[model samples]
Target chain A: MPAVSMPIAMSELIVRLQQESPIPMDAELRCTGGQLLALVGPSGSGKTTLLRALAGLVQPRHGYISCSGETWFDSAAGHYLPARKRRVGYVPQHFALFPHLDVLHNVMSGMLHRAPETRVAAAHDLLERVNLAGLESRKPGQLSGGQQQRVAVARALAREPQVLLLDEPFSAVDHATRERLYGELAMLKQSLSMPLVMVTHDLREAMLLADEMCVLHRGRTLQTDKPLELVARPVSADVARLVGIRNIYHGEIAGHAPEHECTQLRFGSIVLKTPYRPELVPGSRVQWVIPSDGVVFHRRDRPSHTERENQLQGIVDTVHKLGEITRLAVRMEDEDRSLLWLDVPSHLARRNEIAEGVTATVSLTVAAIHIIDSTS
Target chain B: MDWQALRLSLLLAVATTVLLLPVGVFAGRWMAESNFRGKILLEAAIATPLVLPPTVIGYYLLVGMGAHSPVGVWFTELFGRSLVFSFSGLLIASVLVNLPFAIQPAQRAFESIPQDVRDAAQCCGMTFWRSLWAIDLPLAWPGVLTGLTLSFAHTLGEFGVVLMVGGAIPGETKTVSIAIYDQVQSLNFEGAGSMSLLLLLISLGLLVFANVLGRYAGRLHAYRNV
Candidate 1:
């Protein structure tokens, strides 16, 4: 064992989210043990608001936030610890690096009042960890935007906070830098043992970094699950849309049978099979979820065995090229105005001879088709 | 040369700066951070002595501080004498007359600091005064120094106020400007010329000092903004 012992393991965070506003709802979130929880939502979705409430920056009109039995904020008892005492590492959207201080001083700033002696060493270690070695003498203005952001991260970590809250940390950087920083952040979280909660509108970033994903809308949590589960089984049409599920069908359960039967999903003359359960009564409203990647594009017709599963015919409305993937917006001739979006690799798109305003058949395996009852 | 006037002027300028520097710092800080009603009005009122003719200020001071007035009587009771026609009276007038110059620069320096920087400092567990002294003051030093120099320069040029209130008593109430006026009145061009040349040099030196100090502060602020 090393001579220096680790700080005591901190408590999990508990946030009872409520507000006295035009719209009202009760939300209770418990993150037990040390675990990364990603709050994913669109803009104006109240993720930042929740982060602020947890940090005691903004007092929620009601509810409380407790971490490991330590009270940070409790409206009932009037116990609201200031932001400094809460010991949270909050990296705001703008990074908020002190313009006056150089990289070294910015990191050491959080340490000035407490443990002033170890401030320099701690700052240096964190900077080195973030791969900003020997850049301490440079002021924030002198560094590149990405380098400045890394310095801000180092400063936040210098305090050795128990929990870290990051608000769109990489949204300001370019794609290449954003990816590099994300890789560094992944390594940091593994070594630091601090649970991180990051808010990002970027679906791919959230999918890559989050351990548990939360889908929020209008200040409410619609679904909270694993990243894979969030994509596989979205709770609502909104959640499905948020996670980039391009093929969402508004269908009615047409058939139900005994053990392992099938529920016939009818959208526009096009019907698909979902695992049959007794609860899936005929004429009941249901939503089917299929990710854009799950839908395959092809030129030549395949065998009926594969075609019987989850295939639909549509006209290619538009082809939008985005980096490595080409997004094809295909219009289904079905009566249900459901649009199927197929994401094909740029190479595959070039090889398949797909073009805008052309006829194409996109297919999704039945196993890839996920059905959810509207009553949920 | 009328040395008495030169000595009084020097004494008045230095004493006024020393007396009002603390108040100016506080007021400047308040103006930078605090939000209050009629702030513009208060600023204008403080600057009235700078904008209004010195003779008008001198007339008001004369009437307000004379031995017969209530305030003058109370002041006399406290200090065993009145302020009128005294060197100490000139000191009070200089502090009042040059207050805006002292406060304006300091306020500007303080105001130039970004609010986010202060918020970040507060989040790092610093109290208001702790951050102000450690962070804000160092950043605002150039402005404070500029304010000091301006106040000193303005007070050194005091004439109408001292003549109206201090009554030009040799070795007691007379300042450099009053002495120069006395020399001119008595047709002593050589004495007046010597005094005028000295004042000119002093004014130039202070102005140059202020310009350099202000430039340094501006650069620091610009770097921070970047």
Candidate 2:
């Protein structure tokens, strides 16, 4: 038997889930011990199915799920453990707390094999840990949504499971309450040494909570990387859009600067510089993304650099004010009328007097530009 | 008053209700949750008693339980007793006639429970039987209780099926409905009137109790979702 603290690894988790209309799915994921892997996708993207497969709830058509050297499922071996036999703490979307059991009993119900006294003590201790100490006697029906979710988490943990699976656990709660729950979960994550997989459609929540993120689309994993890495270097245009990178354009390699190790890309009549890729030959067509935050707007009175390497002079096509940030659509002075999106702080937008029809000089930071092969 | 008839009827009703509790729950759950070929056919068969006239059911029971039939002959050889025109025969008739009443509402109750609750129970290391006891039964109790009460009440008022299968043996199979019919035929107006009033009150009371329980079940279901 492997120690409880070791990571749970699942390889080639191939499942064909039948829905009202069939959606293809082939998902693979990995989580190190004590790390949180957030599985994010749009609805019907097989995020929940993957979580269920890991918990031994959904039997995949082909796969092997192993944790600490224990085989939970293997197609070749014809070995599959049922959900009850798999030591997984699952917090479903609705929390699924037993309506008949009081909070303490709900937690204790998972510890059925423990001694009575020990179960009681541990249940109480867990309730306190979830900030639900005095509500132990309350039924799930009487508690608030957040409180009920807390009870669910505590109950799942009471099982002393080897892995924890949460499916949109915070989606039901109000935003204010969700923030607090996020704080509680972050603290809880520090103490738990088992692998945890959370399924969420909320990109912000996944970015905020997950140590690593696996972006799923149409039942397949597009990319798996640290949140920052995923946002910074999405593998494809679809992945770039999913990660909130809104500024993408078609460009071909114009030339290479060997001294600076950078490639110049021509987008219509405009040219830009990005880090060089060895795979790229001159004239190779590719898609490039510039993070919206990387497009900087210079003050109207500031002295403009005469160098035209990374700078573009364009007329602001539209302006949208969204609380703290202002989003602008800038149409480049090119034949294709290519538009670039830039997000500027509202304060900066006000100082620069940026608006629709205003000519603005925006610079795309070369270090922030990323390119992907068009074929991928 | 035909006290023997009343006693036998009550006994038959109680026994049928008790016997059908586990069967109803198990069948209800299976019907609600499982999907396989021929499920619709099985459901239609279970519901046949609800749509068919009581005499149709009584006629089948009578034929099936007669000593000439294979099942009846086997029972006679094994137990050394006839199944037809006996208290046991009436019990079987009542169970068949009231099965739909018990199963329909129970199936609805089981179906109403969210699937997530069942999944959560299994993920908590609960076996099928344990989840039924700890979660399904308690969450669906009011509806199940309503089913049981409806079955009991329907059995108490049983007439055609009991009359055909049990044939009005005074101390054995004669039930309240048959006794009242006998009294009315003999022009004993007062006796018939009293028995009629008693039956009316019991049926009315059970119906009211079931209604109250159904309302409570609705409230509980709403609470669970909250």
Candidate 3:
């Protein structure tokens, strides 16, 4: 009924929410100022809901959201701040610009609490930052998709919020516009000191823009780590798949080959040497993944010593040329549905004769074959 | 024409339009945005005046606000006068009868406002009232114009409900339509014809104005999607 205690003074944003019905989720997330955390999940995976919860739009059934020494929500204390009170900068999907207002007034709308005399100059300054200075008089309907997106960004930043939340902000734009916005956002990120959380389904976009990625699947946070780390060594198979890791396989922990400084894993009787995972005792079954970049296509013309390291011979089941790059799905002779996807330059693919039904061997480096401790 | 009745009709129509604007907006927005099992029942209740005969609604209003009824007694106690056959009583009856005309178009317009825009307004340090003024009202201005115009025109031409509830009081409740009926009964065909033609022309003018506002709003809506 009342708040008697003081809000905990902290620098980072701490959000742990539990909600039932309408996307039923349980998640705990943390992001410090100047850090960008990407929420990566498939549709219906509750990524948007989580972002809305952080914005104070969706009230969580339990837990608290604290940011920069202020408590935004705490279900335990029945202290839930309204969306407007949170002072969160949220750029919703499609940019959602006020259709009636011109670009300058739209940005000014976010500065309602500021003095009227100071608003015009500040709004103009924001428009300049967004590269929309000359387009101040233009309505949202008149501007291009990219310009509209910038207006949304300027409006969000006008409030000087403690946190910035972007819900698929670039989704409405064309490829060319999205690419431009990506660069703009990267530059904008340099000026922002608040915790910025972006929800994106694109793993590549997440990796490009975010300092950290939190992978969500079916309302649960499966993992949170640096983009490359999440891709290279996911904590679980679900996380491995969510991060777009293509070569996940089942294996058993064979004895550690300490003399060679590698751990041996039995992939259906084939002993694969991986970076030392000594904590996994012999005979423990595990799941592991390697990125497509790690899957090197061995060449018959020039055989190397490392080519023999964890080299598995397979017949190329599929060969797809993706622009200058070619993807070959190599099916191991002894396994089923176990396609090791290998990327090769188009000219190299031609020289190596990597095509469907052709026999090929690829090597997995000891460091690349990362064994996940949990599969759940 | 009975100019006193014509002036009274204009006064009543203006009051009704002003009174019902907020009511229409509230009901229209709620009906447009909310989804519930009871919503259909609420919608049907608001639509009663559209299907029922004017006298039937007028009869209910008369009874509901008669001297013995709770509302009638309460009004008499507060205002020191009988509720029936008064301007205030007539205004209530007109508002009730025009609910559908004022609310339906506004509801349709509010329904078309993109949900994302409303959510964005909430996150942009805006209170609900601020968003209503800056976002909802501007976006739905066309429908609101349509609602206000229709209700004002309808109130000017109201006859049976006004006759039943207000009983032809000069300079009080004797509206234009009732005046036209009176002229016809008194064998003043010329006066009746003049007033009828005038009502037709005013109604047409309002309708045309509404159409113009609608086109402007439509252009604005289209520009937003671009």
Highest TM-score scorer: 3
Candidate 3 wrong stretches, greater than 4 Å? A1-10, A305-308, A335-337, B33-37
lDDT over C-alpha atoms for residue A46 of model 3? 95
Index of the highest-lDDT prediction: 3
User: Which pairs of residues collide in candidate 2?
Assistant: none
Which regions of candidate 2 deviate over 4 angstroms?
A1-23, A303-309, A347-353, A374-376
Pick the winner on TM-score between candidates 1 and 2. Answer: 2
Grade the docking of candidate 2.
Answer: medium
Candidate 1 overall Cα lDDT vs. reference?
0.79
Clashing pairs for predicted structure model 1, backbone only: A268-A335, B5-B175, B5-B176
Please state the interface RMSD for every predicted structure, separated by commas.
Answer: 2.3, 0.9, 1.1
lDDT of 2 at B109: 93
lDDT of 1 by residue, B93-202 (tens): 88888889999999999898886566566565667777777678878889988999999998888889888989878888888988888889999999999999999999
Candidate 2 per-residue lDDT, tens place, A260-372, comes to 88888888887788887766778988888988877778888993553333888999999999999999999987677878898888998999888789999988888788888
TM-score of 3: 0.94
What ordering of candidates by TM-score runs from best to worst?
3, 2, 1
Chain A TM value for model 2? 0.90
Question: For model 1, what share of native contacts is present?
Answer: 0.40
Which one is best on DockQ? Answer: 2
